[model samples]
Target: MSAVMISRKVRKWEKLPGKNTFCCDGRVMMARQKGVFYLTLFLIIGTCALFFGFECPYLAVHLSAAIPVFAAVLFLFVMAMLLRTSFSDPGVLPRALPEEATFIEMEIEAANGNVPSGQRPPPRIRNIEINNQIVKLKYCYTCKIFRPPRASHCSICDNCVDRFDHHCPWVGNCVGKRNYRYFYLFTLSLSLLTIYIFTFDIVHVVMRSVEDGFLSALKETPGTVLEVLVCFFTLWSVVGLTGFHTYLISLNQTTNEDIKGSWSGKNRVQNPYSHKNIFKNCCEVLCGPAYPSVLDRRGLMHEDSPVSASSAAPSSSSSSLSFSNNSKPAPPTTKTTAPLIPNEHTPDDAKASIGVSAEQSCSPEDLPPSFIPPLASPETDAEASVAKDNSH
Candidate 1:
């Protein structure tokens, strides 16, 4: 096997001080806000239910019916929230930003080598265009290298994410490498919860009418109209939400990723994530063997040193990066004592570099000077001030 000469072209991005961290903070804030909304909704609903239940003669029956329904709703809601948190990543990996564009150009130079075993023919290089613009990207100071294919910058964590997933506001996290599974589960559970509540409330409404002398129920109870209408609306909402999410799940796509259509390079391809049979996919995702790979599980910051991809290039080997121009590299950075290209066809350099430089590049200093604390105003005695002024 021979060494592959990989080059990158990076274009300077707008240096906005606040924009970089805004997404990260925005996600966290959004989650907190959502939590607040859920808490408020729960309280309002419970209070309303209690007040109404006590007023009507048939209220007790309705209330009893709501108990299990409420329990299931709550369980699903909680599960959804948990899934969101789990899937939301901390944005530790290297990704390309709109302003800080980077293009990875790999030129394979085989040394005394035939095609490495298990190595498929290298993917044919094509000019990748986004938004009809021929991309001219540059090295990211944060990632300390060129961005890989299908990579995007996460503003919140101030790093590039591979196979760029969207940042999730609901979980106060980015749905990237580490937490994508959790995010998926969250969506599933949330859909279930909504559906459960919609059904339970419908049943509760029906039971109340039945108990209240079914024929005259609507005529006697003025509130019944409103209650029925509200329940129907909720049902409508649930149906729409469930249906849309179901489609997304079947395609193995995220809400954020799907909303932006026909633009992402990866999405342009027949979505590889969506092609699997739903039942088998679900089984593998939950209990079977098709769980997301280890690389798919953790955020960049949390990843242990040495990046690995099951589908990564065969010549990819484990290598550690010890230093970067922006910051000090990790200690005990492994040397290439072994052949630089391992039999496994792994990239030792890419693996080690992925973890080391990406983690170190995001320094507080990288933020704008305005974000840095100002030094205390230099103090001077009156005499010193007068002398300085006189000299001037």
Candidate 2:
């Protein structure tokens, strides 16, 4: 097996900056942080395993076969929807190109010309009319574009998602237009599965209690207690989630819109996306055509470095840039540099003399008479003066 192994190939999703973990060469994608998701998987698998392994056989033989059959089908559906919701793309929008970003920036600057110094700039928002309703689009600095209507940035995922809904930790994915249907189905099926398991576990225990006494029944089938506990706890959350999502589907609103009071507020803004008919809205939300993933996680990336994306974009008016000029290489300029020479005339007094030689002192008596002091040659001078007087 080691000798027959093949190296994994790098794909486009490997270079993506979004906060998602890609596995199996970009085929499986999920949130980067999925600690809760693992627990969710464990509980689901553990409870179902306990039910099928311990309680299902007894219930099928003694009670009814349809219980196990319906349970298995519901469990399979739940798991399928869970994986589909977790692994599928959540309608993530690609980041704007540097040129596009710069063009937008230039437009913003042009619109807001000559702003006073030391004043805060107004929020970057664009309002567009949708079905007679004004929808505000906010700028996403990270993605470098104004988000589309019903689209928003997920701080956890660090990606702008279309028809954005809240991120679900249990599913380990952001619930958005692409995967919300799967998520809704997952919650619905899971709730049904939990309720079924809980109901049967109690019934199985009661049957044992009737035949072998209640205490003895619990002792013989200890797994029933665990399964019951698991299902009982999970049942409420899944059911509540299912109902809440059902309401949202009917209204044709996202979790984000509902939370932000996009429709119900003091402003009394109506939902622009709604079809006005409850049946139509439900059908549109749950039965509409699924949108394709735009990120193209498995597609080959363009053979260009990421640094090249924004390097050539001008400071302003980037949309009007000439691609032909940008493609041409600029002429190179040559430069000459003179070598440095040390100064020879600089003073050498910076260094102290290690040792000094002693100077000789000459005595006055060793000098010639004319050069001598008068006191040293006093006697000789008197004798010469007497001889001169006799000659006169």
Q: Which lDDT tens digits does candidate 1 get at residues 290-382?
A: 223322221222223333333336534312122212345456866543333234455777767655664576467686766855565446466
After superposition of all CA atoms, the RMSD between model 2 and the true structure is 17.9
Candidate 2 global lDDT: 0.83
State residue 215's C-alpha deviation in candidate 2, in Å: 0.5
lDDT of 2 by residue, 1-392 (tens): 01111124457898787899998888888999999999989998888999999899999999889888999999899899999999989899989888999999999998878689999888899999999888899999999999999999999999999999999999999999999999999998898888888988989999999999999999998899888887877888889999999999999999998898989988997889998899999899889998988887898754432223244444322432333235444579888643222245434442122111111223455557778434658888899999999999
Write down the lDDT of every candidate, Cα atoms only: 0.48, 0.83
What candidate 1 gets wrong by more than 4 Å, as runs, is: 1-91, 94-142, 148-150, 213-242, 253-392
Structural RMSD, model 1: 27.7
